[model samples]
Target: MIYLDHAASTPIVESALNIYIKSLREDFANPSAAHKLGKSSMKKVERARQLILKSLKGSKKDQLIFLSSATEANNLAIKGIKLLPSDRVHYSVGDHPSTSEPVKSLNSQLVEIPLLEGGVIDEAKFLESLDKDSKLVVLSHVNNQSGNHYDILSLGKKVKDKFPNIHIHVDGVQGLTKVETNLSSLIDSYTISGHKIGAPKGVGALFIKDGVEVETQLHGGGHEFGIRSSTVNTPLILSLCEAITAGLEDVITNNKKVKRINSLMREELEAADLGITFPFSLDDTSPYILSFLLPSISSDIVLRHLEMKDIYVASSSACSSKAKGFNAGFDAMKIDQSKHKFVLRTSFSKDTTTEDIETFVKEITNIIKEIKRL
Candidate 1:
């Protein structure tokens, strides 16, 4: 089967899988235990934390808190922030629900960041939206649906330059190890997911910059530096660190390879004369995800047809794939409501080969033909 949903979740690489199995066998002791075996497991967990922080160019003073998933990490970063009713939180509706929903839940006055014609954040208007009361701004490094890569570093710098105290939180689930990320001082908190890169699910982390204190979301044994509390899963943490190391090792090379694959898919799909139009431009978006509009067909219908052929793609974020009605994210990206249901997203990994794209285009072409005939 051609699996082109890496943006949603990816199969764990062999190295990470091996490390997971090994850790499960050897590091079975509770990390919180006072026994020697537990101490050994705790040491491994600390090593994993340092390694992950270094991978993101994070300094030693920064805190890397492991959590259940990106959703939880995002929640901690958002709801944990101390906000007053008069404070304003700036966020785009285009962000993943993990980021957007939490911002909405906050008691602060919510301001929606507008998008330019090309799905870029409106810089001038964004600056105008901020005030002395603006406390936090939530953004996505790489958009899950449209693949638009926002220049968060520059944007964060802009935010800090104007409002020195406004915190910047990034949902980096789709960007970590997939893009060139440096957790500079400009960003206050960033989220990373294991499954997005080549590790198993049920593990993710939040990088809180030094001096940014987020209140504890989960209260238990005071784990994750007291930012998140739970029995730490050593095996999952080791495997996640291994996957992150492997993914970061070849970001430039993997990106180049995936760019070719993305180009091939776009070219072949365009060549099929299937009335497909790419929503995001290749020049600006991540090569890892390609979203297009399928003419005269709901992407959900096309998705089922593709699934019947043992191929997989996505019509929207996997979390909300089953949801119906108006999509706030699409609307924020300037996507016409009329064409929202027709948009199909096919994301790639380094393993996605040219043949996979060719077969996908061929099968999708046939599906469209078959549907038209019916």
Candidate 2:
């Protein structure tokens, strides 16, 4: 299958897979054990941690906690802060369910920031939502569906200037490897998923700024510096480290290539007269993901049609698409449901090529024309 669903989950890189297998065979020991074997495993985990820290450009002193997925990282980031009685939470309505759902579950006051039609959080609305009680603002550095990029530096500085005490937690799941992040200067807590960066699933990380106190969600052997408790998965962590290293090595060149492909896809779709809505201004979006509205067709139908042709894509965030009558993006952007019944998200990986995008555009145009005839 020609997979255009990198945002949903990327195919594991061969290097990451090889490392995963080698580690499982070679370093298979409980990190918590006291024996030499255990110490060996512990050393591998620490080395993996160093690789992750380096990829993020984070300080050695910064806290990096491993979790099962980006969803878990987001939960820890949101709930950990809500433990404080004075902390009010603000998150964009357009955030993935991993973020918005967790923030919604918190007992703390939840403020929803509106997004513009371009799927960007309205900075003015975001500022208006902040108050003295607002201790944390959770924003996605790049939206999962629309790929719209946020000005995290400006937003972080603005929030800091106004509240001084406010903390900004950025969900960087979509941005990792696709965009450059200077964690030291931009954010307090950043969430990343291994699967999105061509690593195996079941491993992710959260970057906690130094001096930030967050209560542990898990209770056990007090692993992860008591921030999270579980036996560290050394093999998966090593694989993740390998993936990150490989991703970072060629990120700049890969990103430019993806952008060029996306531009060509858009031009082709427009030429074919397909109804399209480009959410973010091209200049303000990431190259990896492109979300558009297809008028007069249901997203479900489009997805199924594409699948039948051995092409894979997504209608929305994988989690929310499963829910009945969920309209997270529509609710956030106040988009008219009738004018846009279907949302198609095409995500590209470094391995994707211009020929692949051209085929996708041609196939999709044919599908649209057939639907129009009906």
Candidate 3:
């Protein structure tokens, strides 16, 4: 089976899986409990948090809160900030709903950042859009659909240089462990998903810069620095840390491998003359994901045909796959509305090989031919 939808979720790595099983069997005690085992669990969870923060180059004083998913972390980042109704929030329309929706929920005036020809953030226009009223700027480190890598470091520095008080929050679900990252002292908050790398689905983390005050979104026994309240998921946290460590260790090498696979997939598909057109520039986007348009074919039809052959791809983000019509993300990227239904996305992982791309291209070519005949 060829699974090309790593952006949705990746299979847990072996190291993470082992840690998860061992923790589940041996460290079942709740971290909140006052007993000795609880203290041990709490220490493990804290160590995982510190390890993750250090991996991201975050400062020791910075707070990393583990949550159920990146969606929840985005919510905490957006809603936790104290925004007046008159303040303005800048966000990309192409960002994941987890980030966009929360920014919209705020009563602040909304400014939509524009995307350039290659789906990159319009850096000049974005910097010009900032002002004293721009209280928060929410951005995606990597676009989930188009795979465009936003240079948060450069963007953050520019934003901070111009408007020192404007808060910058980044949704790094698709970028974590997949691209070069340095938290430094520019970004205010960043969100990460465990499953996007090689960890299980039930864990994610939010990094809030030191001195950044975030209001409590979930109230309970004052867990997660009193900003988020939940039982410290020790097992998931440990596994996530393990996966992160492994992913970061080989980021450069794995990225080079994935780039070859991505380029090969595009070459084979384009050579097939199946009327495929790439939406974003290959050079500007992350090599891990590639989305293209099919010729007069509904991607859903081709998706089903591929499924029958033990292959899997995605028509859009897994979260919004079922929703029909008017994809704000596509629109923001200048993708024609008429071609929305024809968009097909096939994302890869470090493990994806040249053979996988070859098989996928061959199968897709056959599927298109069959549909044309029908």
Segments of candidate 2 deviating more than 4 angstroms: 82-86, 324-326
The sequence of per-residue lDDT tens digits that candidate 3 reaches over residues 1-374 is 99999999999999999999999997899999999999999999999989999999998899999999999999999999999998999999898999999988888899999887668888889888888888999989989999998889988889999999999999999998989889978999999999999999989999999999999999998999898898889999999999999999988898898999999988998899988999887788999999999999999999999999999999999999987867889989888889889999999999898888899999999999999998
Over 4 Å off, model 3: none
From the highest TM-score down, the ranking of the candidates is 3, 1, 2
Q: Cα RMSD (Å) per model?
A: 0.9, 1.5, 0.8
Off by over 4 Å in 1: none
Candidate 3 collision pairs: none
User: What global local distance difference test value does model 3 have?
Assistant: 0.92
What TM-score does model 2 achieve against the real structure? 0.96
Cα-based lDDT for every prediction: 0.92, 0.85, 0.92
Q: Cα deviation in Å at residue 295, candidate 3?
A: 0.6
Clashes of 2: 0
Can you rank all candidates by lDDT, best first? 3, 1, 2
- RMSD in Å for model 3: 0.8
> Candidate 2, 306: how far from true, in Å?
1.2
lDDT of 1 by residue, 1-374 (tens): 99999999999989999999999999999999999999999999999999999988899999999888999999999999999999999998988999999988988899999997557888999999899999999999999988999889999989999999998999999998888999856999999999999889999999999999899888888888877888999999999999999989989999999999999999999889988988789988999999998997999999999999999999999998977757788888888889889989999999999889989999999999999899
